[model samples]
Target: MNFLPTDDQLAFRDTAVRFAREKLAGTYLQRARIHTLDRQLVREMGALGLIGPDLPEEFGGMGLDYTTAGLMTEAIAYGDFNISYIQLLASLMGGMVAQHAGRDISMEWIPRVIAGEKIIGLGLTEPRGGSDAAGLQLKAEKTANGWRLNGEKTSMSAADQADAAVIFARTEDSTTGSNGVSAFFVDLTEKGISRTHFDDIGTKPVGRGSVFFDDVVIPSECLMATEGRAFGTIMAGFDFSRALIGLECIAPAQASVDETWAYIQEREAFGAPLAQYQGVTFPLAEAETQLTMMRQLCYYTLNLRDSGNSHTAEAAMCKWYVPKTTCEIIHQCLILHGHYGYTTDLPFHQRYNDVLGLQIGDGTAQIQKLVIAREKVGRVALQYDKQAKGGAA
Candidate 1:
């Protein structure tokens, strides 16, 4: 894989940095205090073409490769930790709609999503358990007019703020686990729908919450692709999102590291700069080393995707490792700031809180490890219970 970025990728990264500086730098944390982003900020992101990097150009996207999308996400996270999620949702859910939804729906909504005119949330994780994604309980019953959806999707990003969402519901009762589930593009304003936002510790601008669907009606056209076949496609998109999330968390830690570097060079201890002490300098060096490794792994996963290769294991590795490592690095950076980093005056605390949330979202470290193990060992672990029972004397 190429270590150096292409001209187009560099240009996209530059644009992302400029956009973050102008639109997010000072205002993001202030807005997060209120627990939501301004609608106008999202529109501005759309105007700058930062919303959907990997989507086709015909659908108002840059049509760049997924690696370039990762670059944009990484760059933006430097300024605003929560706002990067807009691009994250755009890349994952927006791509799913573009590929699986009907032609008319895709033509109408994908451009709006790409342009940031509308926000869409992915509704997969329920209140029961997020890791066992295939074990969803939301039920969609067939009706005369169309389908009636009755369920609650909890911990959805942009839950209350999103104009619409791609919701998954159980459509069949066959022995198949995930195949019994199907995907739907539902308008959030429809009757019988109620929402409430969460008071999350971090990433508040994205508005995680629960969406209740009580006999919500969905037209047949809204069903994405075929019944009993949507989970595989949606999970594949998660493989892509997992890698992007790695950069999303790492970029902020990286920014903290940069800030700490500058601070140590200027601040003095024992009549010398803090940078002169090995205790101060070595930790930063180690943080930088970890950041560099995670960044390379993120790009490698994205490159695998760009080359049309199966990267589920690599993506899982990224999802599990990056956030955990970034959490440690940022913690070190916080301590390096001595007392100032613990306060709200600086962005360090906010970034730490934000990155901490990622360790639980998308797929948790345990879930990602499970996916990686399954890919490497072919589900033997999954059948360990059966094997253990058989081996019992």
Candidate 2:
């Protein structure tokens, strides 16, 4: 029932906070203006062990827990809303590489990924749809040499910039549903691969776009986990990333609120500071309360993960609750800024744009709620399923 962060968590948080303020805060907007990120900054993050601190020591990580990982992500988000995705990707893909990829592949790539020398993107969502992740349409056929991939993955983060990707394709018939999908660690630069970048509204640094694989040959050893069983195994770690995504959105929203509070306290209206008025102050108070609640839930979900407990419902709660609340809170902060927030002159607008994307990505609010419902109701949640029709009364 301890609420305080341990000494190691505090040290990591302090370092991440300092790194964000010093390196990311000042340049975040300027970089976003051009929809580009300095690759060197990622390397700097790797140098500081900020990329994947929760990864094992053998993989060039600090071997911390998921809760500590969330703290680093939250602190980094305070300075740069979009760059925290780098940390998120590091944790997600790096964990997969360490645990699922072959030994030679892990030895060659894991350390480099930890050092920020390479970037790995998740290629699960296709151009057809994203919500039904297991029902992917990408085709992977067995070849004499290995697997031949022929499909396009759209809305992928780091699509054009990623050195590699953990791609999922259907090795079996679509009738197999989730069980038909197989994961592959493919080199993005391999022959027959083509990519195009998207003009996304936010999180510009990690460009989202489509990656087309046209009969690309992948070695057999590149297969991750058991073929056709990879979807559930690889996706087991998604709960961890969902919680981190929650913190990423919350951190920026919290920052905007803090900045707005300072503004209202100093700015005057009708010969009195804005903070003196209940209309202005009360909403801020409400926002603070909600932020505190969401923050506690996020870390608690991570703690559940670190303790090896079932947190599917809690992670879904964090993913849905945090971003939805963040959008509302940041919108208020924007309004509180009184037209200054409307302009690009301040970071509030940018944060708003950045957070809106989260509400859609990493499973939407509706999808998360469905997950929560499924977890809570158990078999009752599946009573209306098409497959359950035969057994239902």
lDDT of each: 0.88, 0.88
Backbone clashes in candidate 1 total: 0
| Alpha-carbon deviation at 196 in model 2, angstroms | 1.1
Off by over 4 Å in 2: 387-393
Q: Write the per-residue lDDT of candidate 2 for residues 27-107, one digit (tens) a residue.
A: 778877666567788899889988988887886787899999999999999999888988989998999888998988887
Residues 39-124, model 1: lDDT tens digits: 78878888888999899887778788999999999999888988899899899988999888887888888899888888889899
Backbone clash count for every predicted candidate, in the order shown: 0, 0
* Per-candidate RMSD, Å: 1.9, 1.6
lDDT of candidate 2 at residue 246, scale 0 to 100:
90
